[model samples]
Target: MLEWLAGGAEAFIGVFNEGGKVFIAFVTGILPTLIVLLTAVYAIIELVGEQRVHKVARYAAGNVFTRYTILPLLAVFFLTNPMAYTFGVFLEEKHKPAFYDSAVSFVHPITGLFPHANPGELFVWLGVAAGITKLVENGTAPFSLAKLALFYFVVGLVVILLKGIVTEWITKIIARREGVTL
Candidate 1:
């Protein structure tokens, strides 16, 4: 499954690379530009909506921060880093319902949610989960630890590159629209 996904991503990259003018103009240029324009429009709408709901001074910065910074941060981190996903899970656990831990305990008979009840246990559980996923999906009983590490590293690199390109383009559009010299 991983290989299949990797192959597909490679194929898309190949298309972008070899398809030249048309593909680049669409995928690398127009699509991203449209997303940036949409983001700017959404930001404007949010500012107006917030001002209508409450005092402009009270909600303006928060709305801007959420749209321009927070959402972008989440997109970049989640795309590139597996560890970031787990970190978010940990943070979410704190706000979870009373039965959240109990639910985990009920499922996953072997691990019984015990392995993920704490931070230290959580990392161990993640490794076990990754190993099990690799095994079930590929018919390999167990996956090599080194291979898992390498996979994480590669995923991290992908997230970094894709996010960098997306955020940079979006920033350029925003800056231009806002009349920032940079």
Candidate 2:
């Protein structure tokens, strides 16, 4: 029992050390980027009053193309957390539950596709593209880096569209059932 307990404690310490290293690495890598992005976003919001921003958001929400395609594409191509914060603020200010639901659905997948607006994302995307090309290369492999990026882009767009549409529909149904206007 003593030997077993000692071995378990040793293994636990090793795992904890490794986990701490990974946590430190992730924080060091992402903290600066997050700080800069958040600062810029907040600065812009301050410059362009909340009311004006909400006006723009309302306009975007009214348009299907802008709401689904353009916004999601921008969010994915840009940084994720910053866009998420901006959208969250917009939702809060606008007080439109449907818009909030739809935007959340649209933003998350794009964030997943392109986590950071860094070269690392591009490299990872390229590697995945190469792997996919190798796997599917029967005749001439049509999986160029651009094509792979585009495919993921389209996938993100499709996910946003589906989620936004479904969420909006469900929200409306629930609102109606509760005798409330969405």
Q: What is the per-residue lDDT of model 2 for residues 89-176, given as tens digits with 9 covering 90 to 100? A: 4332223444445445544344324435433343354446557777667556655545666676677667766666666667678877
lDDT of each: 0.41, 0.56
User: What stretches of model 2 exceed 4 Å from their correct place?
Assistant: 48-51, 68-97, 112-154, 171-182
Candidates in order, TM-scores: namely 0.28, 0.56
| Alpha-carbon deviation at 100 in model 1, angstroms | 31
Report the alpha-carbon TM-score of model 1 versus the true structure. Answer: 0.28
Q: Which candidate is the best by lDDT?
A: 2
* Full-model lDDT, candidate 1: 0.41
The true-structure Cα RMSD of candidate 2 reads 6.9
